[model samples]
Target: MYLPSFTLDEKLAVITGATKGIGRAIGRAIALAFAVAGADVVLISRTESDLSKVKSEVESFGSKAYTICSDIKDYAYIINELDRLIGARPIHIWVNNAGINIRSEALNVTEAEWSEIIDVNMKCSFFLAQAAAKRMKESGTGKIINVSSVGGHVALRTGVVYAMTKSAIIQMTKNLALEWGKYGINVNAIGPWYFPTALTEELLKDDQYVQEILYRTSLKRIGKLEELAGTAVFLASDASNYITGQTLFVDGGMTIYGF
Candidate 1:
């Protein structure tokens, strides 16, 4: 009930890559948190079916929900639709959590694989941050939270390219925050260690990988989706009013541990 002053109440938030995994969990947290604080939500992803599911979940709390099934890689389409979506009101919050990671060793990585990871993770992150900042500047207030990973801050056990892309996200979060902070937009990122979602279900179940993730983790375990969701909400809300240009690691001390 403290949202207008201490929370994100009455804010309209848009979340990308909300169909599954980290993105999906972040979207759910954003929607439910905002609903509890009194706000509306709009969910976006590539699948209409998944968007429908999110909408249903958001509506469960009696909050207004909107959905758009579009690919973030198609920036033009996103721009056009964003205009329609924010017709008369400014978008108060934007969470860019949509990304993909294709793992390969350095020598074996394909040209196409490199391009896809870079385009989706780096290119898309920059442009979307740019677009959202432009609109936020007009309103003179907004927040943009990027869902990064421990991969960005550390080398991944399986994918170097994915790690590189995430590293770029950390810098992107910093640089964008530098440029947009004066415009009244707070730019920040969440770097998670090991969290189970649709993306990591198979890998998380593997004994070898599970042991590896746990061994390096100070908590001696992988993270729960709900655990990271709180950090997302804090970044999106007024509680973090003075925080910006930083990556909050929800990594269970994984980042601090010496390999």
Candidate 2:
């Protein structure tokens, strides 16, 4: 029996915001995927306690694991800490999933709220991608998978700032792919919609929220965290070596539907 070669064997992966939500789910799933394919993983987040628990999960998959605690919003911190970790070890895959969303309308948005949203989702993402691309370029190859949102490709009831940030991600992804494709670094994004996770856990349970989401989602249902794992594994592995500068929407076909 021949197994699919879609594994990330002998590779090293660095996952950001790995303590909770889509980040946590991705961390656990990617660790298992990489281990099954034979690779080691490094988990990053702000809490050592949370990191410990997550590390245990990854280790339970029978693969090696490392932990890093860094506030993604800290530019110097992100660069210094990540640089140290990747020292000597070649980074084969990078998942830029650390992010936050503010619920203020464009009119009510304060300077702080806007900065916080942009700092993590846009700024941190860009710099981390730059760092990873450097290491990848040295080897002439790597994968940068950014976790965007359905809000990114389409303006939802979310807010103007978030929508703007996400759309920026799609464009950033394309731009990175265009510039780095010749260098062998594939830049891509995954836009998730209505997933039941930490970030959306509160929002999903709201009756009004669910109604609005389902109305536009066409499928009339929210997404599951597990459902998104497969797509992440694909984009992070050799299976997607040829795919780049595109975003795969894991929405219930929401981006295409309109009232």
Candidate 3:
């Protein structure tokens, strides 16, 4: 009998921003996928109730699920909580999916908004990855998947700070992979374009905004959350063991399309 290498059996995956939108979908999908493949999951979010709900959903997949309520911007709190929950448990995968953005032009972006966005999207992710990597280093193997955005690669008319932080994520992925490859830790990133997540809900409601997005996208439609989940699973599983230090863009060709 031959089994596929894609199975995550016996592995443990941790995902942040597990409450809503792309993060929620990725959390659920990864939990179920890993469960089906015989692995357990840990979900983290800002809301305990929502985390509990996702916990129930993941547990229904016949895999153990642990939930943590955390504000990603609070680095110390998150790291401490993670250490407490992960005590002596080998974490095979860590997904840094928590992020925030403010729709403001370059000149109009406030210091508070800029600070918040950077703290959540970049600073938190790096610190969290640092914490996870410490454990992974001990085990000599792990996967870290950062949820970046196509905005990181191209200039967007949206929030300039958001794009800046995302761009940093891409670089961070590369650097981490380069540094951690010796310890068998693979660091990578996923860049998604227009998706129907809560973050994009308001903009998607605008017909003109939607049309403008589709105009540059070869698929001419927004991405589905499951698609992003699939990519996350691939990165988390052994299927992508040979891959690292790369950003897989799930943008429906939007990044490559030229006006």
Candidate 4:
């Protein structure tokens, strides 16, 4: 029997928003996962202190860890910084996990709020992928994982713009896969449901919201952060070589089950 190769040995992965929440979880989990398989990682975030802490955690797994303290909002700066850190080395995986959401109703949303969400969640993600893809294209192989949300597929009460950005992300993944498949670049997305993180803390705290979420989900409970790690590892490794332009919804059947 031929078991699939899930090892990312000798690979280098770059994760944005690596300081906190899902990004932090993915950063640490993937770093350690890859390390256990013999890979190095580069953690990127706006906070130097947090980056250092994560770096220590990654290094604890006996893998080399590098940190980049910069704002993902600044497209040019991030691209330049990545180039500086990576030099001639090819990035085997790039996870675009940096995003923000404002919980305003559609009528209450402002121009500033709209732009900020678009800038950080959409614009920044695209440019970063472009930069990573350029390097990956040259190397003739790579993996790009975009962190989308269940809101992308089904509308949520969170905010209109946030849902819109995530929906765009799903489409973006497909488009990128179509364009870059020839270069051996696999572009895909992961849409998660209610997971306990800094971003969803307040929402998860509301009993009413929690009940609603559970009712819709087949698992009838929120997801654990660790539950997402395996999916990320699968996509980043050689096991998902034939999978591209796909959105793997890690939600607990929230997307498939309709009310």
For each candidate, what TM-score against the reference? 0.93, 0.92, 0.94, 0.96
RMSD of each: 2.2, 2.3, 1.9, 1.4
Worst 10 residues of 4 by lDDT: 21-30
Q: Specify the poorest-scoring 10-residue window by lDDT in model 1.
A: 1-10
The TM-score measured for candidate 3 stands at 0.94
Residue 68 in model 2: lDDT: 80
Model 3's lDDT to the true fold?
0.86
Clashing pairs in 1: 3-7
Candidate 3: list runs displaced more than 4 Å: 1-4, 20-22
Write down the lDDT of every candidate, Cα atoms only: 0.82, 0.82, 0.86, 0.87
What is the per-residue lDDT of model 1 for residues 1-259, given as tens digits with 9 covering 90 to 100? 6544545667888788887655666656656666666667878788888788878877787778887778889977887787787686788888888888776888889999999988988898888888888889999999999878888877776778888988888998999889888999999999988777767778887999889878999999888767787787888888888999999999999989984
Candidate 2's C-alpha runs over 4 A off are 1-4, 26-32
Indicate which candidate wins on TM-score.
4
Instruction: Supply candidate 2's per-residue lDDT for 127.
Output: 92
Kindly give the stretch of ten consecutive residues in candidate 2 with the minimal lDDT sum. 21-30
lDDT of 3 by residue, 1-259 (tens): 7544887888998888888655666556656666677678888888888888878877887888887787777768877776787679999999998888888988898989988898888989999999889999999999999999999999998689999999999999999999999999999999999877778878889999899999999999999877877888889988899999999999999999985
The sequence of per-residue lDDT tens digits that candidate 2 reaches over residues 32-105 is 56666667788888888888987887777777788888787765776677667667788888888888877787
